[model samples]
Target: MLHLRAVCPAERTEAALDVLRRHAGATHLVLLRGAAVEPPGDLVEADVAREATDEILAALCELGIDRDGGVTLEVIDTSLSDHADRAEEAAPGDGSDAIVWEELISRTGEESKPSWTFQAFLTIACLLAAVGIATDSPVTIVGAMVVGPEFGPLAAIAVGLVARRWDLVKRAAVALGIGFPVAMAVTAVFALAGAFTGLFDRAAVFGDQHQVDFIYDLSAYSLIVAMLAGAAGVLSLTSAKSAALVGVFISVTTVPAAGYAALASVLGEWDRAGKSLLQLLINLIGIVAAAALVLLIRRRGATDGVTTRPLSSG
Candidate 1:
């Protein structure tokens, strides 16, 4: 279930009410007239089935509540009202399977933005991965993966493709395009510094690193793993079960490959660096392809039982 709070202008209140009343998935509706101080409008709140979110939000958007006022949707973690249960039953699809398009787009769009925090996490993840590669430690590699933030923009790219949001696509692309190179370059510098201090050995990185050897090994299995992880990552975001994302994070070798590429380049092992770069590219491409596919399937399912007329008209 989801909780919707909307501030609607007086003129559009009736229209918003009518739309909410017409939807069987909406319940516990409350209207506080002239309660919005900033917008100087009425505050409307309701509990809605997750599956009906897209449609109800579309209707609100059609009424210009989103443009003239504001609408906020929040997950109802524990709704004790029977009306909420009835609303869920009245809705068409399972809540977990439903794709809230507005919510998904808003979330991915925000996450995809190039921020200092995003760059910091990516750089730190790469640095950790550099340490992992130098030590040939799977544990350190997994830790680096967990700390990596690359998946946000990657997932956003897939969402943008499906939703036809070119702005989002561009933002995600810029984030990734700039982020990875910057992170790799920083890691390369760190590697050079480590080498100067005798803390990193080029021969160790190029030979007998079985535990972390897979970072440079691009194979069919690598593609398959990336595809699965991508699918799972999208599902985790859309389904609001974000705990699953941690598993997805560690399942792919994106950060580790970048780390290896940077380190190999620093060590002047051009061949190994190229192979690691190839591995990174394969994982990235595989993830985006698979995530797009998953989102398309979910989008189709969301549209099956719901009409997009409101969004279309708007």
Candidate 2:
């Protein structure tokens, strides 16, 4: 369930309220007229079943209430009321299967932005993977996987492409575009330092690599696993099953590939470096393509089920 609040101008309050009132999935409606301060409007709040969120939000967006004022939504973590159950039952489809597009847009939009935190996490993850590569440790490689932050921008690109939100698309693209190379460069410096200090084995990279050669050795599994992980990642985000994301993170080889590639470059293993980069590209492409396709399918299915045009940009 979601608690949705819409601030509507006085002139548009009735229309907004009427939309909410007519929806069977929207209950606990409350309206405070002239309650908005900055934009000066009426405050209307409702408990919306997750299954009905896309429909309700699309209707509100059509009214330009989002443009004139705004819409805010938060998950109802504990709705103990019977009315909530009835609301969910009254809505089409199950909440778990429903797509709350606005929330997704908001989430991806924010996460897609490049930040110092994003850089630090990516750099650290790459560095960690480099260390794991240096020592031939699968456990450390897995740890690096869990620490990677590349998925945010990857999912952001999917949502941005699906929504045709160029601002979001560009932002996510820039994040990924700049993020990987910078991370690899940093990992290379770390590898160089390790070499100088006799802490890293430049030739261990050519050894067995603890059977982790899959990070650079491309095959069908590389694309297949990446695609599966990508789909799962997007589903985790859209359905609010975020706990599943860690598994998705561990399934892809992106960060490890970057780390290995960086180390390979420092050791002058041009062939290995190139192959690692190709592996990384495969993962990125597989993820973005699968993620975008899933979003497109779900969003389209929602629109068709409602017999409505695409949700408005507002």
Candidate 3:
């Protein structure tokens, strides 16, 4: 469900159009031939195309049309014929007006950065968990789970693995790595400050906190959950359906473990802190490893028609 438009020279228009038309998924294609004033040599008319499925889009990208003239490609989501008509009517008349994948991923990249907003969200989420534990409030604990910002790094790691961009991988790793310690330190300072101020009790913070301690006990289920969530995260990134990703974010314990570690430090429960830290590490490692594995397998499958390759980077 994507709408694509391209503006290329008249000479290459036929080949491009043929490429688009031969694909069965491309249903509506309108080719207008002309030249733009700024680029005098090239054709100015718009060639509009729409894909009903993502597979078709991938196929077209794999074709990789290399042309000298200016070309703009766009993808639009259409659920019905009426929507397609509306997309056609709304097509851009000029070179500036076009749909492109790079643009879509760029906007996504901007919103998904590890910025102060994410820091604030994680801080608040941890605070909520601390308060929830103190007040014995299950609702607040779940709210904390929902508010945590654990998905950003997970996603960055996944994207880096898929695109084979180590710089992105390192940035995401650094951001996530630093973010956890910062959050833990801040939580400790605040929790100790609260304890001294008689706002909360050390015992209340660390006493009999098994629910939060659940993070430390790693099992097969842990690996399974990480793999499932990581795969879903990548799928969410590539596909149009994004709502399910939020639930996946909340289900993972990366942020909560960091919060608990900080809270444990404030309470002087070093054992709890150590356990939580271990859990956090296990989950983070599990997620990164599983995500990398999944992407590798998927890429190999796409290229070789084999989905499960050996789990070695080499």
Candidate 4:
């Protein structure tokens, strides 16, 4: 899954090889005794490995090669292998030492790279929600939830915090903050137009409503739902075995809440509209806070020192 080639001192070759064999997830091991030579990538390719990079890197730190000594660690993605005879070694302690903060940050960056398609998806979700609100159709409201793409940035923000990438955090925050308001504004315009046309004021709409039909109900369940969604979102980003993020995205009601709020505001139900807006705000704050907290915990395990690359002026 990962290809690693390292050049180290003749004396430390065995030790480095031991670490590689023990924690690098190398099916086959190779070590060349020479001066510092860069790996295939000019920079250290730490994230290429499918497994155990974090553990191997920690072993390197423990072996004194990371700090005092001069050994270059290079990793890449390839199926190639070079076998080297080595003495038997013990396995790392359940491979807990690897943190790979750089790799995590890089992944977050990759995830945060936005596309026009996502914007289109958000627009569609908002419009679908407006239609649902206008027609009093809960099924269409759920459709809107399924269509929204807010989870990408939500998960991206969580990963950024775990990786200590403030730039990513800022970008994700901006995307969410701006996007939600934009969606609400667009839906609000539609709601106002629909209200003037008597679409929302149709007979027998509010007369037959049940107690549970309050779209603006900002009860404990509202906060609980947001909390659960936030937790699942972060977990989906971190774990390799799970790809349940899309489901989480569909289950979250943020866009629906906003659309409903806009519709209610247009219908002169300011009380319900304000409650729905508060619910939306609560969801956003809860998700962001939870994501940041999770990331902070993950960052504690990171061995890579903080990188201070200059921001691009363009």
User: Which candidate leads the pack in lDDT?
Assistant: 1
Q: Which lDDT tens digits does candidate 4 get at residues 203-276?
A: 43444654325456777777677777787676566554246766676656688778877767767777767888
Judged by lDDT relative to the true structure, which candidate is superior, 1 or 3? 1
Displacement of the residue 177 alpha carbon in candidate 1, Å: 0.5
CA lDDT of each prediction against the hidden true structure: 0.89, 0.87, 0.58, 0.60
Question: Who is ahead in lDDT, 2 or 3?
Answer: 2
What tens-digit string does per-residue lDDT give for candidate 1 at 1-314? 88999999999999999999989899999999999998889999999999999889887887889878999998877989888888899999898899988888778878888899999999999999999989988999999999999999999889888887777788899999999999999999999999999999877766777888788877899999999999999999998889999999999989999999999999998988999999999999999999999988878877433222212111
- Where does candidate 1 clash, by residue pair? none
Model 2 misplacement above 4 A: 304-314
| Candidates, ranked, TM-score | 1, 2, 3, 4
lDDT of residue 199 for candidate 2? 84
TM-scores vs. true structure, each candidate: 0.95, 0.94, 0.70, 0.68
State which candidate, 2 or 4, has the greater lDDT. Answer: 2
Ranking according to lDDT, highest score first: 1, 2, 4, 3
Worst 10 residues of 3 by lDDT: 305-314
Clashes (backbone N, CA, C under 3 Å), per candidate, total 0, 0, 10, 3
Which residue pairs of candidate 4 clash? 54-98, 55-98, 162-295
Q: What TM-score does structure 2 among the candidates reach?
A: 0.94
